[model samples]
Target: MAASKIAIYGAIGANVAIAVTKFVVAGITGSSAMLSEGIHSAVDTFNGVLLLVGIRLSQRPATAEHPFGHGKELYFWSLIVAVLIFGLGGGVSFYEGIQHIRHPEPMRDATWNYVVLGLAALFEGTSFFIALREFRREARGRPFWQALDQSKDPTTYTVLAEDSAALAGLGVAALGIWASHRFDMPALDGAASVVIGLLLAGVAVLLISQARGLLIGEGIRPETARAIRSLAMQQPSVQDVGRVLSMYIGANEVLAIVDVNFKDGTATGEAADAIAAIEQQVRARFPMIRRLFIEASEAPVDAAATA
Candidate 1:
């Protein structure tokens, strides 16, 4: 979470400064691509704020009405951020590009656009590296795509995705600006804006998919579940392990319920002790399992039926 905060803060600061500069340059040069980039940065800044709000809200304590706490708040806000990117960012950029293409206006000198773009690249690049570093650290030694697929925390990856899109948008904007000046064709700049809009829309769709999955209650990986089942089976009083159900209640919190069948003659006291021991061992191995429920069941009719 600390890493998430650092990445988001860096992004917000960089985007705020770059958005202002891009808008100023766009105003002076009347460059459609630059204006679109400005809108992108502004939208990113606001998205960063929404992420922060999500993080804060997700930290709220669990209550009677909400037994799982407010952890899903982060996923909810992440979805909203993706929607805003698609709407305010991508929609506006696409519209602006079409308008510019229809009413092609000659651009002013390209010197300021180049200078501003260079600075924007530097700032945006720094933020991107920061986010990538944090994400990689969290991923440990896992493959990038695999780690991303299993990640429960939305803030870290969301920033990484946004920065990645921002960097790509910058490249597109730079190329479009150069092409317009070199060919003396202003419509190319609008074309660049269109490309950027499509890029953002693509990123938003991916983000929405991920956030939606988490918001609806994603579970731990199959490997983790199998490991946990094995751990439960290792208990002497346990005859077999049945269902091992798990769900992520927060970024670092998990709630798991396991059905264990005990030996037919096992005393209730012995079952209780075994359950306590099992809980301790599981929690020791996977500290993220904040809440665990172990249900004792009758001996399985089919001993081969295991989780």
Candidate 2:
């Protein structure tokens, strides 16, 4: 299976189990943080399902109305996931925390909370480790942060980010429960929920920014763009290379347009041959470039016009 699918499946299984256990434990122990964690897990489970749906829809063939295929469906669903995280996970947690703060109550039988928390951590941690490994595989030689910025597949990175936050939230919940009992201050539990809410909001904002960029047709990496321009400039009949426009149509698919000016008195036949050779060479060099359009011009094309 694809990395995205693997990450989503692992997360869905872990979250569904964790959410059920946490909700039951929350009801038994009446721990605000536990309840918040349950809500978070539930939302994550639904998000995973949505991501799978996105993957399916994104695979649909291009239609007359949409020549570019349904690849952007993945971005659209990812944006929805971010909004749901902010609204359902973050908003609910904040509200619950405030309510608990205004009317604090002593947690009953905290032992069960600890047990459930420990088990939840185990499951969540496993899923997080899987996501991290998949992300590392995608990163390869690049630094993790740089790879994340360059990544076109939103599903994998979104899962990694969510899992990272989930692990952090679990730690906060454990601390809050311990401190509330150790210090005889019940307010700490609510504070933990608020902290978890803030963490989720931060993740959501980051995801929204990434999804928006993808939806708006983010260009290829600068290095890739430069390489493409160089490929065009290397053509024998080309006098000068003009604007080279490149955009990612999908994770592994790129669309590039090369504008070139031929040398003075270059025959039409020679220009055509050069254009074909350039196209073939570019595609051969970068297999990800699925579509290449070469335009022969008498004069160097305007950069501003291309932009």
Say which candidate scores most in lDDT: 1
Model 1 CA deviation exceeding 4 Å by range: 299-307
For residues 1-307, could you state the per-residue lDDT of candidate 1 as single tens digits? 8899999999999999999999999999999999999999999999999999999999999999998898889899999999999998899998999999999888897889999989999999999999989989988899999988888888998898988898899899999999999999999999999999999999999999988888788888888889889998888889889878988888889999999999887766668888898899999999889999999887323433431
Error of 1 at 138 (Å): 2.5
**Model 1, residue 76: C-alpha shift (Å):** 0.8
- What value does the lDDT take at residue 84 in candidate 1? 97
All candidates' TM-scores? 0.94, 0.93
**Highest-TM-score candidate:** 1
Give the C-alpha miss distance for residue 254 in model 2, angstroms: 2.2
Q: Per-residue lDDT for 44 in model 1?
A: 97
